[model samples]
Target: MSATTTYNGNDTFHGWAASAKGAPLVLQEMTLKQWTEDDVEIKISHCGMCGSDDHYLCESWGPSTYPCVVGHEIVGTVTRVGKNVKYVKVGDRAGVGAQSGACQRCENCLTGNPNTCSDLKGFILTYGSRWPCGTPSYGGYADKWRGDQHFVFKVPDNMTNEIAATFFCAGITTYAPLKRTDVKAHSVVGVMGIGGLGHYGVLWAKAMGAKVIGMSHSDKKRDVALELGCDDYIVTSDKEDRKRYFKKMTHILCTGTSPDFQWEPYFDLLKVNGHFINVSLPKWDFPPFHTYDILKNQVFIHGSAIGSPNEIREMLKFAAEKNVRPWIQKYSMKDVNKAMENFRAGKPRFRFVLEN
Candidate 1:
């Protein structure tokens, strides 16, 4: 390991960071950890805003270690690659997701599940986390990012940076859960919450040959869901709509979260033994339910983390081949505060991407 790091001393990387919890990000200079042969440096071109980013900014997921620079759906050009790096090289366009590093020796990591690495420090997040060298891990809301190359991926030439950025987080989050299930032409897949993650779930499920149904509490996203390839749309708040789709889905991918979220009706929407896979990370714990419902329905209720490195690579390839592009609203990286404001207001039609 070299004592020489990429952004050192006077050669600091600049980013918009939150000085305190819930504070708007301000431009600031930051340093990188000690450089290793497995690291790669990226000059960021685009980054997608995620709900998880907000959770960190507001400290809803617990008190965030500030000054936090959070934007995990990252895409950029590789500016430098350490000697041991091989997945990508300098000048190649690359992208990173919520994960930056994990202990390679962990059972989960060795089994190709680094996204859920078992070691205490193995699940190194791109932001709101710390590196082994005691440096606070910053994310892609910056001019550059330097970290373990294993978590970084080369962008497909068929996709633009803005489009590629969304897949790293929102895309992978939904895709991984759905891929775990056997969704095919005969399957009826329900995508709950037609927002950032749900939109991708709809897209991926449809591409996987399933009859996709877009579900939301209200009808606001109905037309957009149809445009995103959903075969049908259901407003779950409507009793008639709920009755109409009773026991209809082979699996339900819950991608949205609200403090007042209702879960019982969605459980009824699932077929016997259907999967109710939730990938949303809400600040509030789910309201309690009766075990009778679970026993009677014989359904599976589980949660999924972000995808492993191999899963991410597989998703990117599948997305590119299927032309699975996200509906993104772009903002200049300098207007990050404005973007955050809009995000808080739920303004993104699907996803928001920041350009450098």
Candidate 2:
């Protein structure tokens, strides 16, 4: 295989950026670097707008680098691949998620936990971070992107590119915890929140043969949940009705970050020895409960980050096998600012994907 030469042109690509603190995202033109031997250049086809993207671009989480291009849930075609890249070939459809690179030789990497690699200092996030060579790591909001082969995954031939874009982040975020839990065939599983991550949780749990229940604040989504294969729908705001459904769930997955949420209601919903898993990044006080609740029921609470690459691959395979698909709205790449605004406003029907 011949090595690919460097690309050196003033290729104009449109991407949205937050050039300063507390400012709205603005569309900008950037010069893309030439492709290297270890690089795969993708002409981004679709990029999912995640909550994290909004958090980063608006500097909500913390101070962010200026000129940061922040979309991470990326699906695109490998327009060019470096000679050393064997995992992806030119023209192959691929996706990139929250992560872009890690130290592959660390203990964490060798053990399929590269996401937790300790020696890598700061993890190379897909956007607003410096690459190993010191160039900024841009994301998939633009017309194209160049990155190492390790961070990219080939989109299964059977999956639509729009859905594949979501699998890059939302799909894997929920799939990781579900795979690690005790919920299985005939188990009662409750998914709180009907947005991106919560929807995937309901779908995957149902596909895994669990009796899945969709829990939300409004009854309007009840029909949508059932249509998405949920066996039951619980409106959490109806106190008496919600109580009636409590104590039936063997497992509860909380995808919302309501710090003021009455935690006792959710705990009451769990059966003896039930487990509650949290995947949402919410600011909340710890639940105030007695030791009796823990001892009598053996209930447990836990949290999970996004999955490892191996886990992501398995989740994609599972999604393909189960015919799981996310409800998404597509926006043109040029309208990235509008997409970010909509995501911040929670305007997508479910998830938003930016298509080039």
Candidate 3:
């Protein structure tokens, strides 16, 4: 038999899958992509739930490929590793994030930004994606996960799987932008939203020695933000509150996906030539704004995705050293629906993780 058949014959994995758009995930059996020498198979122990999973499930981002298993922030035990896989061995604790594959030859990939690879074949998401060979890729909302070893990361022994799982997606997404903006002790950083991604932005910015200001629509997350180490909290809608911190921040990390996000007011909060990086993926298109906001102050606006493999490693080590941990609520893998319901109801203190 050929290699494809040989590999396909060895295993059929099981996971919770959505059969159609807006459908609830149901237990199902599925097959992984044809294994290659560069592949690794993991028996999942924990998986973090991200906002992106809900977007894909509800077709909020767009139409998703169905029969989709959608958890990406994965932490697990390495059950098997292909001959070519190194660093990750059987029984080792490892994790995979939002990215699964990328075209290594691309300039972005070679330069350590595989998450933003330019080629069509690159930018493979952990789920809601297909392998180049036309096989559908499943994610970590299951008993096992298989993917390119290059995208798999070894978890730090000092961290628990539940905590490590959140780092894969939420941690990297926030950490990448903070590092890129060169946030330091002198920098005053504004972290908007105070939810899943925003909480991390607040934690890491403070950990990086920057003074963090937690900005939200109201006082709901004020206590939590302060608990997460925010130097101060701002209610974005309050004009008096806005005036106190106007033009004070050196960098602002916008992590909220609200369709009604006030654009111009946030620009007003930035210092001249300051950077404002947005990491949220909202289903709605951002409202238009005036060009004067950019020309008048030379403000820089950017959009960042998840981090590279090297960045992931760096983030993990930093998180361990700093003792940074996410506030999370856990659910059994079998109760994914109930977990998702709580998520939709906005009940998570910050993030949620599923234990397999």
Candidate 4:
């Protein structure tokens, strides 16, 4: 590999960045990273804001690097590409998700699970971290973003920028888990929390030929759930209603976490050899479920991260063909700080996309 070249000694791009944790994100100028042989630079047209942005901005997850630009659901046209970037080229439509790079030769990566790559020493997140070259990694809350070829996904032409952007994070997050379970026509899949990930969960489940049941706490999402192709909708707000589905679902894809939620009922809804997959990071940890239920029912509780490069490709193709779209509220990049506040309060109907 050859040495990477700096964009220009003094070249900088404009974006919204947090100067300190919990501080209002302000418009600021940031330096462009040096170009590596395997990197792709994008002039971002759309960026999907995520709760992870709020988590880091509020320091909920942990301490974050200051002057951080945080929005990972990114989509744009490729403006430049490194010499060895085989897939993406200059002027191509592209997108990137939660990750930017990973050690491609590792055991986990070799098996096509780079999202959960075991190469901890070389794993790189899209933002709130440093690149392999020690550059402070800023995410898609910017005019432009540069990522490695490995993590950048080529957006399908049929998909719009905003929809393709969510596929980078929210879409793939749900899609990966379902695909891993190999959902098919006869599968009975329940999508819990019909919001950001849940919406995608329902669409992906239905598109994958599963009989999808959208389960939310209220009736607010009933129409949206049905619009997204859910075969049935269940309001889990009533405890008695949950019992109606006792041992009904073969798999439950949990996309939202509620502190006051009763777990036993959802557990009871699972079949003898059921699977409960959780992708949401709720503030409160769930209390223990019935020990006997787990032992006797053989339930599998699975945690999924984002998808690998191969999986991303498969999902993009699937989404484009099936027109898998996210219900999004579009906001301009200038309104990001205000948008962040609302995002914390759950203002967006499903997902929020920032147009640059």
* Local accuracy of candidate 3 as per-residue lDDT tens digits, 148-203: 99999999999889889999999999999899889989899999888888899988
The lDDT, on a scale of 0 to 1, for candidate 3 is: 0.89
- lDDT, candidate 4, 141-206, per-residue tens: 998898788888788888888878988889999999899888888889999988778888988988
Off by over 4 Å in 4: 1-11
Model 4 is weakest, by summed lDDT over 10 consecutive residues, at 2-11
- Model 1 C-alpha lDDT per residue in residues 217-323, reported as the tens digit of each score: 77788887898899998886788887888998889998885678767887898889999999988889988888888889898997999999989999999998988
Top candidate (lDDT): 3
Whole-model Cα lDDT of every candidate shown, in order: 0.88, 0.80, 0.89, 0.85
Q: Model 2, range 137-252, lDDT digits (tens) per residue? A: 78887778887788789999998888899988888988888888866896899999888888888888987889998898778788888988888888877788677766888888
Quote each prediction's TM-score.
Answer: 0.96, 0.90, 0.96, 0.93
CA lDDT, candidate 3, residue 268 = 88
Question: What value does the lDDT take at residue 103 in candidate 2?
Answer: 79
Clashing pairs in 4: none
Cα shift from native, residue 11, model 4 (Å): 4.4
Candidate 3 least-lDDT 10 residues: 1-10
Query: How much is 342 displaced in model 3, in angstroms?
Result: 0.6
lDDT of 1 at 199: 88
True-vs-predicted CA distance for residue 8, candidate 1, Å:
10
How far off is model 2, as Cα RMSD?
Answer: 2.7
